[model samples]
Target chain A: MKLKKNLALSETGFVFDPSNGNSFATNPIGLSIVKMLKEGKDIELIKKNILNEYLTDANTLEKDIYDFINMLKKLQLNENETSND
Target chain B: MKRKKITVAVTGLNAIDSPGPGVPVIRALKDSTYFDVRIIGLAYESMEPGIYMHDLVSKTYQIPLPSAGKASLLTRLKYIHAQEKIDVIIPNFDAELFNFITLADKLKKEFNIHTFMPSQAQFDERHKANLPEFGKKHGIKIPFSKMVFNVGEIPALKKEFSYPLVVKGKFYDASVAYTPEQAATYFNKIAAKWGLPIIIQEFVIGEELNVTAIGDGMGNTIGAVPMRKQYITDKGKAWSGISIDDEHLMKMTEQLFTSTKWKGGLELEIIKNAKGDYYLIEINPRFPAWVYLAVGCGQNHPEALVKMALGEKVKPYTKYDIGKMFIRYSFDMIVELKEFEKIATMGEL
Candidate 1:
């Protein structure tokens, strides 16, 4: 799963797809995950960082992260939606 | 003489395919010779192009949608008023007018925010459902209209309305139906979006004429400009329009003001038939999306509205150059996500 290179993600969680002119606003953690994904961070690494920083257990964090990624895909923010790795 | 500086807050900044009157209203305010204005844009969405148009809107704060109800709206406005000290507020959206009207008196007493608008009674009378009665009461000819709650009611509409009638929502959206089946389908569509009581009206076939006018609280008109839409968008909004000289249209506008004792900005949507009679189709209590045409024609309705809100004596505008035209165009600006972020997260930018 990869973040779209065409998507402009701001520090404060505003996402704009210049290609389609669609804009979206996400929460703080969502912003962090998008930034990490843009940097080509692996799911395990992103999961580890979020679990350590946020007040959540491993299972819940995993679930939440996956849910958010699914949402990104649904919103067409993912570059390669079917990428398994 | 130095221009007196005052802060003004305006809503309805969405300048899109279905545009709002905010940007052009701000432009009119900016052109004011008397007041050097600081514009505070009240936006409902972060991406409303007006929020990012820094040259026109000095700053923007996202307010809760009217569907969220009035208290939340007031709280947000209170926060904005504390920061901006807004002297006047011009609300442009039809959906949000009720909330603003409800807050009008309190805004004046508590924060001294002045708004010039029609009374609650006048506002209610002009609603799409109520327009037939409103036209009747004011001695204006209106196309026969009936309110329907269910698809079953659509079949019965053939008695009063002919084929190719208009199906309208309570607040927005309208579709022309040439058959009962089409009317039922459009009923479901409009009712799904805007909710119950879809309005069915006799579709008057004629040239559409519009007049943007402002009325003093008393039975006096402060400004009136008549125009014919040259081009219309798919959403039924005027894409290009021209000011025209029409005595009957102007007289009808005067009669409406006299009868309603309307206050603030109003746009009369009229359809003139082959028999040369005008029918009142709709009355938008706020300025129409094509309000800038009024400015282009030299009426400057929004500016005059501000003057009235501030309690200045404004004489009725008697003359406007006929045949002035306005053609709207869209521009794509490279807005940084940071600006969008501030408005989304912090609710202000």
Candidate 2:
């Protein structure tokens, strides 16, 4: 799933959605995943990147990534929802 | 350019659990770039916190409440104006607006005290009881509502409305009732405080949004800022909110001014459902307690209102910073007993 094109990700992990002016703060891992999504990386690539950089196992990483993506969808930060308008 | 000095009087200084707009309005005026203001706090109660906040209010004078009639209010204002040489008066209480609006012309003509306010006709049409007709006339979407004066009318409401409707007072207080019994209970409870014609409104589930805007009285919208409550207190007041970039909301606000030529500061309580439809919930005819959020967003509505009250021409603010948030916190100030005694006994401090 793609992130909203206009979502502004700051160096401090502050996420600002310009379309609706909603803001969110994420941890380092969540920030990295968001950055990866912004770069149009697929879910498998994101999962692999996180696994290589951290101590988590493949199964846990995959589940966490999917959960994070679902959160993005729930907050309406996905490109699909923005484009639907 | 040098700023002009002006003496201004403001009321509703009760900054408590459910805070009034006075303190924030004063904060905005103090931040004004156009004028240097000497704030005179007009209060109905001696315990109003703004009276004791010496840094914000230059002098505090106890005034009669709105129930004391306009004549008594005008007489007290005359006395205060005599001492303060007041240039403008801003009444911030919803309950006191009628007395202030009635005295607006007399205040200007007699004491040279300027006030920027909506006309009686404009004010009357936007009341809670008149909102449905107002929506129809202006082509704005509002939830269906009916006014009931007695408990006898509550049973008939089931025919026109469903369960989980809203029961509201004329001026303040609202409750969502899931059954007719709850509706009757809320009606009596609210009516006891605010008095009759309890309004029964259709409950439309949605994400609530609000817009604080200023109109120039000539169909020009000077500034508008839309916000969403990030956190709310138990009393339903916004503890924190963030400014949003909603083009549709801004357009709707501008269209409202264009159609009504509404003067002064107004807040539009709105509900936007999942289908993206906006329903006008209520219209508060003055600056809200959270108006400082608009100032933080770079619109500075109170500053604009002051300029308008002084007859200065103000251009519309075309842009404001979005994603700006305001987190409200309460503070306790320690005051000596002498200061309290002074206001309580002499009515001035």
Candidate 3:
């Protein structure tokens, strides 16, 4: 999944969407994945990177990543995947 | 000239849509020319923005919520005091005021933590449940009101209060209802959140004015500034306001202070009806979110309060700049995850 092009992400984990003037915050792990997504990393690559750095198992990381992506979609921070994808 | 350094602890740092006054009060204290302050922020949640604003707050410790009662609050405060040697604590939330007020004397005696607040009698008299009697006793005009425990009593309110009546919760929230059914609906809504003893009152229609003032524990008003809200949010908080020159409002404020022997900071919500009469709507026992506006007008009430708490003799402020306007703005502050993790895990940052 890709993040909205207009989203402003800060190193401090503060996310601001100028489109709606709404701001949000996330944990360290969430921030890492969002940064990877913004840099055009796919879900498989993002999961592999998190497993390499963090102690969690791959299955748990997979579930958490899905949940985090769902939350981002709910917050409208992720752009809908188009037919080109 | 060097300024004396003093450490002060303040609560109510949640500067959300409807804000708590703690942040503005701290801003004023930091600007004081008389003393340099080291601020200790006491927060209930890890995500309270004031806790993350490192420049505004020296350090923040997460404290137990007021619902946990006075004992839990004191235990947590004692721990903070052991480390910080907090000199004064300014509580800015109404829900937590009771516990702080209960422990005020003990705090002063045991730890030398000073708090300038209204006496228990003064606080009780100004509650929404007792405003009618308080108005009569103090000779102040207030809207006729009655307290009801259950929604069943709402249907009978028609004989006393007319249409477009205000249904209010004990601590917060209010809805204007045009009929008994609507009143009952709001009654249940408010009662579910703030609990029983819901207040039903005659809805006064007029221009709303607010006065933020501080009393010197004696029968004197230390400082008072009146303002008219120019823009209000949907939650009924003042978003932008302008200071006004009103003699009648000043006189009423002095009367309330003198009659009640009020101490510390308070906000007087007043309604001026069609007949030119002023009705006191509510008396919030602590500083309102717009307190910095008073400091902007040269009153510097929080500074005066700190002086009084330190046992300094302070004279009443007699002048203020009129027509000064304040518009509230919100900005995003980038916060590091490590800082958030620290507060969340260790409960202090």
lDDT of 2 by residue, B1-349 (tens): 7889998898879998888999999999998888899999999898899999999999999999788999999899988888999998898988899999999999888888999989988888889999999999999999999999998899889999999999999988889999989999999899999999899999999878899999999999999999998898887888888888777888899999999999999999998887778899899999999898888888888888888898989999999888888988888999999999999999999
Candidate 2: residue pairs that collide:
none
- The 0-to-1 C-alpha lDDT of every candidate, in the order given, reads 0.88, 0.90, 0.90
The better candidate by DockQ, 1 or 2, is 2
DockQ of 2: 0.42
Taking all chains together, each candidate's TM-score versus the true structure is 0.80, 0.93, 0.80
Provide the global lDDT of candidate 1 against the true structure: 0.88
Which TM-score values does chain B get in all models? 0.98, 0.98, 0.98
Q: At residue B70, give the lDDT of candidate 3.
A: 98
On a 0 to 100 scale, what is the lDDT of residue B76 in model 3? 97
lDDT for residue B94 in candidate 1, whole number 0-100: 89
- Order of models, best lDDT first: 2, 3, 1
**Model 1 lDDT, residue B271, Cα:** 88
Q: Write the per-residue lDDT of candidate 1 for residues B24-45, one digit (tens) a residue.
A: 9999989888889999999999
Every candidate's CA RMSD: 21.1, 2.3, 18.5
What is the lDDT, from 0 to 100, of the residue B217 in candidate 3? Answer: 81
